[model samples]
Target: MGIGDKRKSDAERQERRRQRLAVDGIKPMTVHFPDQDRSIVRDLSRRVLDGQSIRQVMRELGGSNQPDGNVVPPEVLAELDYVKARLVAIEREAASQLAEIEEAERQRRTLEAERDVARVAEAEERAKVHTTATEAQAATRAAQEAKERTTEALQRAEKAETAIRRARSLPGVRGRLVRWLAGDVLPD
Candidate 1:
């Protein structure tokens, strides 16, 4: 056959398959296996081509899915849920539903309370850290001030010692007073 004729035939075959599958109520699926398992997959494919039942083979291989081969569409399932809720409302007491709502509200309030407690704890911890940092800064300032005072005291002592050395050659009282004030600076 020509390429156009082959294409037409293939399209006709797929359309026929779709109608058959719809009638049979079976879904089609595609599976891919690793190249290393090519031989095993080929054997399964050959069995399916030779008219072996795929579902039967799956059952024999320990699968528990014994479906009735019918699939309910998602739209139908959603409609069923709506109808079920309506039926329950018509048959049950309004107070029962009210109780359920109250329980949900209580759960929401409990969660909010927990979050509030966590926020409070976080704030307290942050305040504590800030206070500690402030105290550390105050301590650093105090140490710097103490070092500056010690340096000034050392400078004054050096000046007094210089004066005492200069006056050591004085004849009498001045020399003695300088020596006494300096103490260890000039020997007797």
Candidate 2:
């Protein structure tokens, strides 16, 4: 067959395959064409329907396969790459700041716990001191009561000695009786 006849035969076979796939409930693949030329668009469509990937189709059409590469100029691509890098740097800085903030918060909580423990210890110490002071006050009060009792007993003993001396000086009181009253030794 001639080249044109072979191409026509291939196209007929492709159309029959597409019809069979559609009847079997299978969807046909599609591709986007940017050119306004009817022949080029039809060719790209046929390539896509023939199971060619979008990347292959784009490369075959002399278009960039990278996303947005064809639509954007070289200067725009450079700017976009710079912006993406800047965005990544900013994200990393934000993460670092977040970690620092979390660490600071943890330290603050630890310090607060330490302060609470110190405060509890101080309160316990104050309670102990208060209890000690109460006990000391009670002991001091008991000591003062004992001292007052001893002072009263001493005063009474002095009065009794004075009465005995007065009685001994009377005419009827014998020396022996005076000695007995004074709790002294008597001669035989």
Candidate 3:
């Protein structure tokens, strides 16, 4: 009816109207495809409502066959590609850091094991020294006891010798002591 509305009853008239619509500056409303970040899709129904040419809009945005082989707006599709590349780089960095952390943990465990071994060795050495000192102390006590016994024996022997000498110095005590020692009774 008007310059924008080009609805025709006949097929030929519709074709002519479509061509005229393409020449006009009318375009479909753009819709952002959340699933596809790098591209957007122009709504053909909205284009018809706005008295615009759906074919022209489809052709302008790569004819609905995007570079990625999908009917998506070029803008959002490019953004998605960029996001994918960034995510790959981030994953690579994370993997590297994880490897480093694993290595560091391994080294720490190794050092701890070594330290435990050293501690055990040192403790064993200390135990050995303690045992040796105990043995030495016991030996020293035994030697001291033996020396005391020998001294007591010598003192007893010396006392018996002195008693024998005193008896000999007496007049008849020597003969009487000898008779008693021989198990024979002496005259009073």
Model 1 has an lDDT value of 0.79
lDDT of 2 by residue, 1-188 (tens): 89999999999999999889898565676766566776777877678768877677867786765664346788988999999999999999999999999999999999999999999999999999999999999999999999999999989878877777766676655844785666662222
lDDT of 3 by residue, 44-111 (tens): 45555576565666565555544433467878879999999999999999999999999999999999
TM-scores of all candidate predictions against the true structure:
0.44, 0.53, 0.52
Candidate 3 lDDT at 186 equals 21
**What's the lDDT of the predicted structure labeled candidate 3?**
0.72
lDDT, candidates in the order shown = 0.79, 0.82, 0.72
CA lDDT, candidate 1, residue 93: 61
Q: Any runs in candidate 3 off by more than 4 Å, and if so which?
A: 1-70, 173-188
In terms of lDDT, which candidate is stronger, 2 or 3?
2
* Native-structure RMSD, model 3: 13.9
TM-score, structure 1 vs. true: 0.44
Query: Model 2: runs farther than 4 Å from truth?
Result: 1-49, 52-76, 162-178, 184-188
